[model samples]
Target: MTSAIDIAALDPASRDAGAVAHYGDPVREQRLLEEKVGLVDRSHRTVIAVPGADRLTWLHSLTTQHLEKLQPGQGTELLILSPHGHIEHHAMVTEDGTTTWLDLEPGSQLLGHLERMRFFSQVEPADVTADWALLSLVGPGTDEALAALGVDRLDPPDALDVPGAKFAQGTQPPRPSTIYRVAAFGAGWVRRVENGADLLVPRADKDTIDVEKVGLWAYEAHRVAAKRPRHGFETDHRTLPAEAGFTAPAVHLEKGCYRGQETVARVHHLGRPPRKLVLLHLDGITTDELPVPGTPVTANDRTVGFVGTAVRHHELGQVALALVKNNVKDDTQLRVGESTAQMDS
Candidate 1:
């Protein structure tokens, strides 16, 4: 809606729904993110407010990450799961001393699940999607970009208080949650969601920031090349956290009881996920057609898995992120449509 229109205003030829599509030459735009700074639109995401006397404790009793001791402006991510341990929802979590904000993907029933789980904890779930918008700066000079806004030496991952800026709608920090740094472009996720730092602002102030805007294509290509697992693209109802490689920062192995802790532990100790996510080196020179998201991946002429994303990286050429059988070797040769794919390290 607003995000689509905003990107359209910036790049008239860009194709997008909520996330960025691209202006032109996605590869150049992707390189811009690495070499300099590029602004990204992230307004399509969902933000939920959970506030109550027992909200923190109740939330800690659930999800994978530890949130019981969250301080003001401290942020961490968490995953809500089925009792059986199937991946359900991944949320970007943060707090501002009052309401705990859970930023998540659109169409997630996490709020409904919370309502159902709210027996008497005094927790309330409110959709605040209309109240805020997310814009991210991708590149090495993150502090420089923030300095341009008169905000300097930002202690990222936490939140920043911007003075005299239109992005802040209230007294809350500019980032309601974690400012996930792009690990692919520079460091690791720690690793942040989709490899970028996120900033939240009132939708009314979306146009106030002064930053170089890059297309969605740059962001998507970087994600695929770096082998990041997106919400709907790499994971689903049947997905496991380990299957998508969300073990360390997203899930703590020693945390107390939660919905899927047992299964998560069981898989880590003895069992392995049926499939594992891997980076695929697509044969770009030989094959004209690249694998789409759901193109079956095969090894030894048998269906092992399917393609998640096939992005033509400027440096890596045509590459993809694929989910394949755990047994498939890292160097195994695979096939996706007419493209010959290989499981790369």
Candidate 2:
């Protein structure tokens, strides 16, 4: 789908206004968010389609979510891990009876892994990202804005039924759309508007709204505050899901078998993850001299772990998400660059 606005057109303004925040300068988009409830262009995310008689059974055997029980219109966060139990991709899995859809962040390599797995199974996998357009409506007044859009149902469809226009999910007629509720900042929600690429309509109702285009800066701050981890940053192929906080709702301990299950189960039962992801609030630090990703975290001259993401909070000062040794106490002082950081409660 063609974008209505070009990044180049807004580049100068974003730079001059210092609004190009978030990982990709989501400021212009954030502005639309503040003025009127904004529709975020999320077409960059990739979608993979799994279809066949064994679609549900096949995906159930692969992902971390309980795919076997998913009804239509229902979707849940899934983690695809490596054989060693390291995170490969974090996805939103939705089932529509005849088929299952895996929506993931771009560069997750989910399609490649799916294709590789097809050689061992009867499930048919295809890249369907081109067939859909995704959008996220965030900021304050999102619920009212959604209600104005004729979406009254607050609950998503069951995991196995075909997903359509509903609370978090909306699909243009004839084509299927699935929406997943993801963590966001103050009064924020993500909506995946699939199909109807031509019907690019922004929400028109405006009441009690303070929409601001959230740039990477704002998003980073919010994500850190929420203690939510990203794909490549807080997690990676070398990091176990348990270590990255995927053992909760994202990982299914009761689900039978899947890649990395043994390690995940072992860690869960032991209740001792090798590393822990912690929120760090650093004092005497500035954004211009923030610690780089993967910088080793040291406590008492002993290497503990590394930094994942760092951002200067508007109120909290310089903060970061660090992968640290599980043994570190909340008051433990860690050396990161020239600054010392303490784990925030």
Best by lDDT: 1
**Cα lDDT computed for each candidate against the true fold:** 0.70, 0.60
* TM-score for each of the candidates: 0.82, 0.72
Candidate closest to the true structure, highest TM-score: 1
User: Mind giving the per-residue lDDT tens digits that candidate 2 earns over 1-345?
Assistant: 222344335554322122233434444443444444544444455767788877776777787766665666445677888898888888766555566767676545788777877755668888766665344555455556656655453433212232221213222121112234322222222333221110112223112333333344554565576687877778745898878766554665556789989887777667778888899887764435778678888898898888888876666778899888788898887888778888974
Tens digits of per-residue lDDT, candidate 1, 1-345, equal 122224456545433356667655576789988888788777777878888878888888888876677766456778888898988888877666677878887666788888888897888878877887766778876667766765434454532332222222343331222233322111101123333466777777766678877767788787777676876677756788888876644675555789988888777666567788898888886676666577888988999888777777889878888778898888778888877887884
> Which whole-number lDDT from 0 to 100 does residue 131 have in model 1?
82
Error of 1 at 308 (Å): 1.3
Q: What TM-score, to 2 decimals, does candidate 2 have?
A: 0.72
- Model 1 lDDT at residue 316: 84
